[model samples]
Target: YDPKRTRFRNQHRGRMKGKSYRGNRICFGRYALQVLEPAWITARQIE
Candidate 1:
């Protein structure tokens, strides 16, 4: 994932800049899955 893009989203859409969203692990995990699954799958597929 692009650090710049993540930073932008965290700052703008995520509303999580410089603040502790640590209690929201489920939300963060879901967001991470949504962001990373495509690349992760493409890299691991056996076909």
Candidate 2:
């Protein structure tokens, strides 16, 4: 997790961005989740 007030550079954010193999959330207040790969039976996130 990161501090909401902390700033991130474009390069730093790009490096931290998640790939398709791992689940990630899209930006812009979409409130959506992305799961492109297989995961364990109980591994999940709820928001």
Candidate 3:
């Protein structure tokens, strides 16, 4: 084991079972883009 390196635990890809009710409104910025459909957004797309 390397003490200088950080290790992350494995996680399960759980179900996204329902429509999200939280954060439906824009809290910051003058403009916000809304997602009309479900999507698999990746980290590269966000950056």
Candidate 4:
């Protein structure tokens, strides 16, 4: 049982699910950036 590989597979599956759910309006990269940017800015401000 390779946990790392399993985790990667699960994440990949989730990304695919998001793509289908959004009807391809958001690619994975853009979706991730959209999600991360706000949190990233907030973390930077706190630092």
Candidate 5:
């Protein structure tokens, strides 16, 4: 998600339940997530 353009990234947030994350997933390392506040993140989907 690009916080600079859209905070919610096409309306996505919170926990995702089975078969949902396949297309919508963000790869943030444990340390990154812990260090970077979700709001402060400029983007998601690491890969």
Candidate 6:
């Protein structure tokens, strides 16, 4: 979906340089999907 107000600074490229400490472990399900690398999820791929 398109945003209402488009800013110049908000159109910058994304970087996966840092480490995430939060949500490293599963808290709900017995089998869960964890991502080792960064990726983009399209709306069509959700189904």
Could you say which candidate leads in TM-score? 3
Q: Please give each candidate's TM-score.
A: 0.14, 0.21, 0.50, 0.14, 0.16, 0.44
Candidate 6 has which clashing residue pairs, if any? Answer: none
Decide which is better by TM-score, 4 or 5: 5
> Which numbered prediction scores highest in lDDT against the true structure?
3
Tens-digit per-residue lDDT, 1-47, candidate 3: 75655576555767665555698788988997777666667999998
Residue 28, model 1: Cα distance from true site in angstroms: 10
Candidate 6, lDDT over the whole model: 0.71
- Residues 1-47 of candidate 1 have per-residue lDDT tens digits of 55645534533334323433356356533453223222323545645
TM-score for candidate 6, please give it.
0.44
lDDT of each: 0.39, 0.49, 0.71, 0.38, 0.43, 0.71
The runs of at least 3 residues in candidate 6 whose Cα sits more than 4 Å from the true structure, single-residue gaps closed, are: 1-10, 42-47
The alpha-carbon deviation from the true structure for residue 6 of candidate 5, after best TM-score superposition, in angstroms, is 11
For every candidate, C-alpha RMSD to the true structure in Å: 13.4, 12.8, 4.8, 12.1, 10.5, 4.2
Per-residue lDDT, model 3, residue 34, is 73
What is the lDDT, from 0 to 100, of the residue 21 in candidate 6?
68
Over 4 Å off, model 1 = 1-17, 27-47
Candidate 3 residue 5 C-alpha distance from true site, Å? 17
Candidate 3 residue-wise lDDT at 1 = 75
Lowest lDDT sum, 10 consecutive residues, model 3, at 2-11
What clash count does candidate 5 reach? 1
Better of 1 and 6 by lDDT: 6
Assess candidate 3 and give its TM-score to the true structure. Answer: 0.50
Residues 1-47, candidate 4: write the lDDT tens digits: 65655534533322222223354355455443233222223566656
